[model samples]
Target chain A: MEKNKKNKLSIVSLVKKYLPATVALVPLTIIPAPAYAGLITIAVSSTGALNFGSLDAGGTGGTVVISPAGARTQTGSVVLLSGAGLESAGLLSISGSTGVLIDVAMTNPAFAITGPGAPMNVGGFNIDGGGSSVSLTLPTNPATFPLGATLTVAAGQTAGVYFGTYTVMANYQ
Target chain B: MKNTKKGSDIGKALLMGTALVSLSSYQAEAATGTGLMSAIILTPIDVTSTQVLHFGSMSVTTAVGTITVVPNGTGGTRNAGTGSVTEIAGAGLESEGALQITAATGLVMNVALTAGPFTVDDPGAGLPMTVDTFMGQAVPAAFPFTTSIVGPATNVIVPVGATLNVPAGQEAAVAGITPATFTGSYTVDVNYM
Candidate 1:
């Protein structure tokens, strides 16, 4: 009977030793963690459209390229026009938590621009300053970047205004 | 036993909470934006042959000779290489081959001619004469030409010329009673450079 009483006392001592740590965990589990509030919020918007100005695709077709710096160039039989407006690269505005590294990508790298005539292909998407990835600087909620691409004009491409849509995605790295 | 069970429940709750937080964070950390792409296409380049190249009538003697037609607009000159060959001069008898190319003004283009030593055959006579050394004369420029400037007023014209080889003692058509006429063709290709 004396031995049985000793075992019960030891059990009580074991619970006392571990009970404080277990009690500490209960509040942490029930109160809800505040780390959720620290999650970064990311948003992307377009500031301007990517424009390749007037061009002539001669007997043999050619390609027109727009650089991230908003400069336009061409190859093959494509001719650049001296119209009133200047060609420009696409502009994107990204807003996110400061000091976070962000990745930039084109959901559709290659697509076609349609118009009255045949469709012209657009590809070779690029970004300036940083390629494919960028970091948000301190004190700036929204960071802006430039994007560019190449347009393929077919031989005897019908004369008209061509239009296409592209998607740019931003994610925290 | 009761304390141990309570600790286990707390651990399970912590794991579930952590999972929920991860899901919420992922949903808010990514976004997509759309941008417009645009281009304006102009008219395409066009080319056509305005005039056909013709080498005039000639008579061969006892020696081998050649006839050369110069490519100089419509009034191109024809010359006999050897003294033995005689060129029959007549109105509308011979002229240089001409091509009219049209494209955007100031656009540069390349002109190519495909003519190897080809035979000009007269069906009446079994003997055939070979024509070779084809050349092109581009106005505002010389032969072996590279670029032609497109026009605000007139399209660029390229006149072609070649040499015709006549064998010694060549036979006439229809048992030497009627004149023999020979004919063959060459290709001209033009493209924007």
Candidate 2:
């Protein structure tokens, strides 16, 4: 019996000495594996309308030009009637992956301006720089893009209000 | 009993040593890597007009004068008091041009107007009068989008005013019957900024 007791005591001492190492082994199975993959996304929004406020149609009539930079000029019978909301270039908000390229295109090159008088043609649409398609390098954050347009005013283009529609497309590159 | 306990201790130590070695092997095999993917989406933008701008009809006089039509009221100097700017009643939302825009929530937008003055010519007399200085007022006071939170659409009302300069002794549209119509097209551009 005394021998058996001595043997049991030695075994217990061995377990106590190894208990710390067994506990330390638990962490090896519990540590989380690291993730190595990620994804990127992009989006866009609008700010306001492009305004070409007011112009005087001289007896002969003429054309009004709005530069992509929002500069205004008049020709022929068309006189730039001075007033507020007179002229402003269109603005757009582009956002997405930082340091990425984006392509912009206009679906319609020309549209009609219809109002009280006969329908008038509004052509020569330009965005940012002069061209049908333009490319931009998107910033890491959201940014603004300016668009300008020009219209062909006809002789005796009646007197009244006019409206038209156009489309702009953007693609991630 | 002593033999049984001794045997069990040996078994336990061997089992623990095997587990420790297995754990070491797994730690050595631990490996990692990384990858990347990209995506994007867009929504359409739109604006619908609710009201048409109108500067009421006025009578032309032989004497030189001007007619000014502002949002609050329409009044300019009329020689002989015969020529005046009158207000025209209309159906629906009054005050000028009203527009509704649709786009992504919280998106910012810019409103731009470009057009010149209007002109009226007398068919019988072959003379023209000019309506110059076109001005516009937005209901919110500013042309920027305050919020797209309510929905994808925002409403805006714009009231337009203009000035008319009539040359001295300008002929009327008719002998004493009709008022010549003066009309022209204006362009409004809206976009995301």
Candidate 3:
């Protein structure tokens, strides 16, 4: 009977020794994992560039518009000329959880394209068919869309090729 | 021993509940894309002189004479002023200077001229002539004029004319070989109004 009591005591002591470590691990396992939204990623197509094509900014300046559909038009003294590097809308490919509502936006609503001549203003940024935001279509893991904007050319805009960079962002809604 | 085990289990359950409550919140994720924008701008407002002003051949006697070339259409009308001067008809085509200004349609531009009583001299030892009263057949009928580039046309042509003054007993030929030939230059300035 004395030996049995000693064994019980030793077992109790072992449980006591390990109790602190067990308690420390309990919180970690019991804490529910937070639900996470799918990560959204956006990229411009390799062959895509927002191009206004060839234009003649006559004696009086005007604006050139490139539609999301890649159609080019002009107003005022701006003349549209067809040649190499013809007008095209920028193509954006988005990848994420399908059916996730997304909000797309231009980091800079208005910016400038500069070259040998005076800088031209680029504004009125829009997505394909028009709108600042878009919803990812269902079942389409990687969705593609077009982006377009208006270019304000100064009167007597000097002759040369103008270049600039613009940024866009996509976020889970 | 039963009492001690029950108390430890109760304490662990309370801590677990607290941890679950603290960890249940949501956050948003975002991504960005960069795009290259480009454009090509062509030349604007190109001005060129298509034709030069010419004064047909003329003969002068002992009296001072003058030749007035008026800007008509593409050509000019030459009139001999009061003196012993005669125009040698069929010698050459006398035309007014033509300046072709290319720009955007419906654009209005201010036209200016650097008028000169320019001296016209020959290669030989002959009397020199003077050209003055530089004029352009433009709107407002005077210097410092303005022209509108009409639609369906990207350019406009302005005709320029002038007057030439000859001295008495002007030489008829240079080195007594070729007919006396004179040449000079003038200026035309244009700007956006």
- Give a tens-digit lDDT track for model 3, residues A18-74: 456555433434444445533444333323889998777876888988889898888
The complex in candidate 3 yields a DockQ of 0.27
TM-score of chain B of each: 0.69, 0.50, 0.68
Which digits, one per residue and each the tens of the lDDT, describe model 1 over residues A36-90? 3664578888899999987878768899999899889999877777543658999
lDDT of 3 at A139: 48
> For every model shown, what is its TM-score relative to the native structure?
0.58, 0.37, 0.53
What is residue B99's positional error in candidate 3, in angstroms?
6.2
Indicate the residue-level lDDT of B82 in model 3. Answer: 48
Question: Candidate 3: which stretches are off by over 4 Å?
Answer: A1-34, A37-47, A135-139, B1-28, B50-90, B93-193
Give candidate 2 misplaced runs (Cα > 4 Å): A1-45, B1-193
lDDT of 1 at B67: 88
lDDT of 1 by residue, B11-121 (tens): 344332122222222346779998899997755556687776667876667777788877777656787656557888774578777777765556466776654557788
DockQ of 2: 0.03
lDDT (tens digit, per residue) of candidate 3 on B85-112: 6777786767788889986566467778
